[model samples]
Target chain A: MIEIKHLKKSFGSHHVLRDVNLKIEDGKITSILGGSGSGKSTLIKCMMRLLDSDGGEILVNGKDITKVTNPFRLAAVRRHFGYLFQEGALFDSMTVGENVAFGLSYLTDIPKEKYPAVIKEKLAMVGLKEEVAKLNPSELSGGMRKRVSLARVLAISPKCILYDEPTTGLDPIMSDIISDLILEMKKKIGITSVVITHDMHSAFKISDYIAFLYEGEIMLYGTPEEFRKTDNPYVRQFVDGSSHGPIQMKLMRE
Target chain B: MFTAIGKVMMNWLDQTGGAADMVRSAGFWLARSRFEFKQFVLQSITIGVDSFGVTALTSLFTGMVLALQAGNTINNIFGDPIFVGTIVSFSLIRELGPVLTGVVVAGRAGAAVTAHIGTMAVTEQLDALYTLGTNPTQYLVIPRMGAFLLTMPVLTVFSNIFGVIGGYLVAVYALGVPGEVYLSDITTFMGAKDFMHGFIKAFIFAFMIATVCCYKGVSTRGGAEGVGKSTTGAVVTCIVLILVLDYFLTAILAAFGI
Candidate 1:
């Protein structure tokens, strides 16, 4: 379980995250739902310590990780969480097999002889063929790249998986397939998942709990049913996908 | 105007500090034996073998031009080609070879490092490495640094050899200076210390290029345009610094009687 209390982060005067507080329950799928540039990614980056918080307590399983400055200690904390980048940041220099085996080579004590079998197994788990491993990331399609990135993450067998905009830039069918993969990961691996996304359909489909982040703070935190029934105008506007509301979008024409 | 000057000064200080910090971190990892030898070899091949043709060509032409000009001037003044080899050998070994090789590698390999790492930076592969419990400085910067430091001096030595051959060809064939005189002039006038002066400069220039290029690459932001800007800036800064540093290094080496 991860607990974030009064987290604050800013870039100069531009307050990207302000007073964010939430709890991510263990073995559950928690979706941080927010529109573009709403600090959803920033919140996760801060949790991962990819971006430092201005002030906060990020307690992971009763330990305050925000105060841990030692890189080795931070690596120990981060070892439990697998993060999937928005664009599937696979190493372009490596083959897909090498990419999948990368974390295993660094983070695991597994014998070198077992890497091929493990690579095949992880790629199979992500529904990719063994032959796909020989190809470079540049040859793969957008959806395939995402799966390869997931397979790479799963190679480390982290306790939790963080997905950043997993369903973005995909066909509807591919998006649905990715959503199912997330569910399958939970059912099979039983790992906790935190998904940052603006896709309402995806967030509604796979999330066990949803947090609505608006203007850098959680406007609502509840189940899907509760989110649908919420009275808050911002949450309502976002949930209903309505253009006319108190939450206005800045547009070029405006 | 004062505020603008202060802002520029702050930016300079920030970048200098950042580069120093990165080197320190890389040194820490290196001391712990965290680097991959395979990466070092690969980067060495990329920096040395891939760059040999251009470095040799540049040095060859410079040597030929130096011999041609100096031989003609001596012939017109004293009615004989004199000290052509001495002038070419001294200039090429003690000054031109190291500086030219440094600039060529900076423009070629240095730009490439920045571009490759900059793309990785914008694509979040650096962050991905962190998530995989790997340090980018250890995985990326250290091997490249080792490769540059090891290969730059070797390339400079080759450049010096090729340059002397170029001058010998021009002095003996084009200027009618005897081959024996040209060879003897080089052997008699040039010493080990002259070669040491350039070799030391090459080593220092290698460090500067590696630090500047890696710093620019790792800190790259925005997107493709940012990578372009960083690559250009890295090469330009390296070339300018190589020239600027050569003067100071010459003075220091001279004081030490190197």
Candidate 2:
């Protein structure tokens, strides 16, 4: 289980996450859903120690990694988590196979001869063919890039998976494909997963629990079923994808 | 007005503090991490080998111009142009060779490092690297630093030789001076310490350019516009710092009786 306590992060005076708290249960999917700038991404970054919290503690299976400053020990903790970034974030310099082989090449004790096989195995896991591994990220479509990113993540064989805006730029069909993959990952591997996305359909379809972050705090966190019955107008507005709601959209006025 | 000044001062202090922090971390990582030997060698090829053409041209032209111009000064004083070789060799070896290479490489390689690393930062690749348990400092900064440290001095030596040859061409063929006069003067005026001083400057310039450029890169925020801004900022910062560092390093070296 991963636990985030009183998590606070700010940029200058504008606090992005304030007093946010949540517990992510082991071997379950927890989708952190929020509107733009609602701090869902920040929360995930804080948990992964990509961005430090101003005031918070993230206990990963009982160890608080924010305080783990030793590079080797930090790497040991980080090795257990796989991250799929918002834009796929494949290295531009390397081809798909090289990107997939990166972590294992640098950080692991894997034999040099097995790299090609390992790369192929991870690519196959993400529904990518071995031939596609030779292609650069620029050659792949957005969906293909995301899948390649997923393959790269799986290359490390992490204990937890963190996905930030997993379906951001993909078509609806592609989004559904990613959503399905998320579900398949959970069912098969049974790893702890934290997904940050505003796509409620993907969130509802894949998440066992949903966390609605607003103005740097968890305004609502419960099962998908609990969210369906909640009276909170802001939550309702976001879930329904309606323009008229409690959440106001600011515009320029003459 | 006082408050506004104070706010500006605060921002300056903040940025300086951040740069200092990155320097300290980069230094620590450079010390602690296992040298990625392959990366160091590849970067040596990239930073040293690739930039050879432009660096050579700069050295050759600089020495030629010094011969053409300064030969006149010696002619005016001595009634002959014999001392042109000595002056040109001395100036090229002690100052112009390393400084020119540093400036040119700062524009070429420094901007490249910033753009590449800045693009990675904006695209969340750095964050991804961190999540994959890779230290960005070790993977990105250290190997590049090592490459620069090893190659910059070597490049300086090459630059010095090319520069002297340029001066020789101008003096012997263009100015109608004897080749033996040029060669003998070089042996008389130039020594190991002059060459060592220039090489030492190359190392310092390499260190600053790598650190500043990488710092600008890693601190990039926003998006594509941020990457552009960081790249531009890096090049400008590198040029200015190389010039400023040249003066300070020279002064420091002079103080040590070099």
Candidate 3:
């Protein structure tokens, strides 16, 4: 379980996260839903320590992770959290299998002889063929790259997985496939998962608990059913995807 | 005015803190690089093999030109053609060989390293490595440094041999100097110290070029345009520093009688 208490982060004069507090239960899928510039991604990044929080306490399994000072200990903390970047962030020079094996090689005590078998199993789990493992990221299609990235995340067997806009560039079918994979991984691996996305369908489909982030605060937090039933104007406006509503798009149009 | 000055001082201190963090990260990477022996060897071979043809060709031409120009001057004054061999061998081994190899490596290998690493950095692959419990500096910078350090002296030796042969062809075959006299003069003129000087220079030049290239590459920002700029900057800085350091090294060696 992870606990975030009184988290505050600011950049220049803009407060990206403001007095935010939340708890992520073990073996549960929590989705943070918000439009762009609503600080969903920033909140996730801060939790991962990819971005520093101005003030906060992030406790993982009853330990304050923010106080980790040693390099090895910090690395251990990072190893517990697997992040699937928005862009797939695959190493172009490495093949799919090599990319998957990268984190495992560093973080685990697995024997060298067993590495290939482990890589094969992980790739197979993500529905990637053995032949595709040898091909570089450039040769793979966008959907294939995302699958490879997912395979890498799973290979580490992380305690928690953070997905940042996982289905952003995919077609609807591909998006559904990714969403299904997310659900399957959650059920099978039984890891605490936090997915930050603006896609309502993805959020609604995958999350056991939903947090609606608006202007750097959790405006509504509950089960998907509770979120749907909320009478808050902001929540209603976002759920309906209204063009003119309480939740406005900050667009600059002449 | 005092308050404004105080703010500026505070900003400078903040910038210094960031720089300290970058240095600390670099130190951590340097330690990690020690374990990646295979990567260092492979990268070294790749860098050396790719620059071989160009370094050899440039050394050959430089030797030919040196023989042609200096041969006329030595013959006009001393009337001994054997001196042409001595002059070419000494100059090639002492200065031209290592310096030319450094320049060629900078243009070929250094720019490539910068561009490749810069692209990885900009695309967030470096960040991915960090998040994956891998040290980017150790994984990236150390192999590059190791490869350059191991291959440079060997490349310098090759450059010297090829350059001497280039001069030999110009003198014995083209200008009618006897082969025996040319060989004997080269053996007599080329001392162990001259060879050692070139090797030392090669090592220093390689270290500087690799460090500067890797630094520029990993530090790059913006995007594709930024990578291009870093590549160009790496090559230019490497060349300038090599020349400057070569002069200082030569002077210091002379003072120490080494």
Candidate 4:
């Protein structure tokens, strides 16, 4: 379980996250829904220690990971969490198989000779053929890259998987495929998964619980059914995708 | 006004703290970066291959220039053009060859490596490495450092031999000096001490260039413009450090009566 307490993060004079608190239960899928500049990405990044919080306590499995000092131990803590980057973040220089094996090779004691088998298994789990392993990331399509990235996350056998806008830029079918993969992984490995996305359909489909973020705070947090029934104006506005509501789209003046 | 100044000072302090954090993070990454053997080999070849032609050409010209200048000066003083071989070989091997090769490599290889790594850093590939539990420094720095350390002496040796040969060609064929006399003077005058001095300088130059280039590259910000700036900065800094250290090393060597 990952717990965040009284998290506050600011960029210069502009506050991104304000007195935010949340919890991600073990062996469950939680989706954070927020608009652009709504601090969802910042929250995940803060939890991962990719970005420093101005004030907060991030507890992973009852231990305060935020204050961990020793680098190797900190690395061990980080190794337990798998992060799927928004851009796929696949190393362009490495082959798909190599990229999948990247985290495993670094974090585990697995020998080089056995890596091919591990890579094959992980790729196969992600629905990629063995031949795709030798192809560079640039050669793979966007959907394929996302699958490869997912394969990489599973290869590490992380306790929790963090997805940052996993279905962004994908067609509806591709998005559904990725959403299904997330659900499959949760069912198969029982891994706790946290997905941060603005896509309401994707969020509603895959999430067991949904947290609706507005103005750097959790405006509504509950099960997907509760989320749909929420009378909160912000949550209602977001869920219905209504233009004439409390949420106003900023106009760009030329 | 006082309040504004105080705020500025505080901001500066904050920036300094951030820089310290970045340095600490870099040290951690450097520790982990050492594990990727394949990346190390690729970096080594990248640093060495392209610079080979330039290093060779630079050494040849440096030798010829030294021979021409020393030939005139020594002829006027000793009335023996043959002594030019000793002067050329000794100077080239002990100082000029290593220093020149270092400068060439800095411009050719150091800048390229810095830009390549710096772009990767700005693109968040470095962060990706960190997230994967791999240290950027250990993976990136160690290989380049290893390549620089291993390849530099070889380049220096090539420079020294090529420079001497260039001088020999000029002395015997171009300047009408006897081949046997020039060859014998070069063989007799130059010793292991001179070679040792050159090799030592080469090692120091390699460390300086590799470290400075990597530092500049890894520290880069902004975007493509920042990468370009880092590349130029690495080459320039490497050249400056090489010259500065050469003078200091020469002084130390002289003090020891080498």
Per-candidate TM-scores read: 0.98, 0.95, 0.89, 0.87
Tens digits of per-residue lDDT for model 4, A71-128 = 7886787887888888788887788888988887678889889999999998888888
Residue pair clashes in candidate 1: none
> Candidate 3, residues B142-242: lDDT per residue as tens digits?
78887898888889999998998898898887777887887888897678888888888999999888878888888788999999998998899899989
lDDT of 2 by residue, A1-254 (tens): 88888888998999999988899998999999889988888887777777778888888889887888777787787787889987898988899998999888656789989999999998888888999989999999999999999998888888899999999989999999999988888888887899999998899899999999987889999999999899899899899988877676531220
Q: Positional deviation of A164 in candidate 4, in angstroms?
A: 1.6
lDDT string, candidate 2, B90-125, tens digits: 888778887888887878887888888999999888
List the lowest-lDDT window of 10 residues for candidate 4 chain B. Answer: B15-24
Per-prediction backbone clash count? 0, 0, 0, 7
Task: Please state the CAPRI-style docking class of candidate 3.
Answer: medium
For each candidate, report what fraction of the true interface contacts it reproduces: 0.86, 0.78, 0.65, 0.49
Q: Residue B84 CA error for candidate 1 (Å)?
A: 1.5
TM-score of 2: 0.95
Which segments of candidate 1 are over 4 A away from where they belong?
A249-254
> Candidate 2 vs candidate 3: which has greater TM-score?
2
The alpha-carbon lDDT assigned to residue B164 of candidate 4 equals 84
lDDT of 2: 0.86
Top-scoring candidate (lDDT): 1
- Lowest summed lDDT window (length 10), candidate 3 chain A: A245-254
DockQ value for model 2 = 0.75
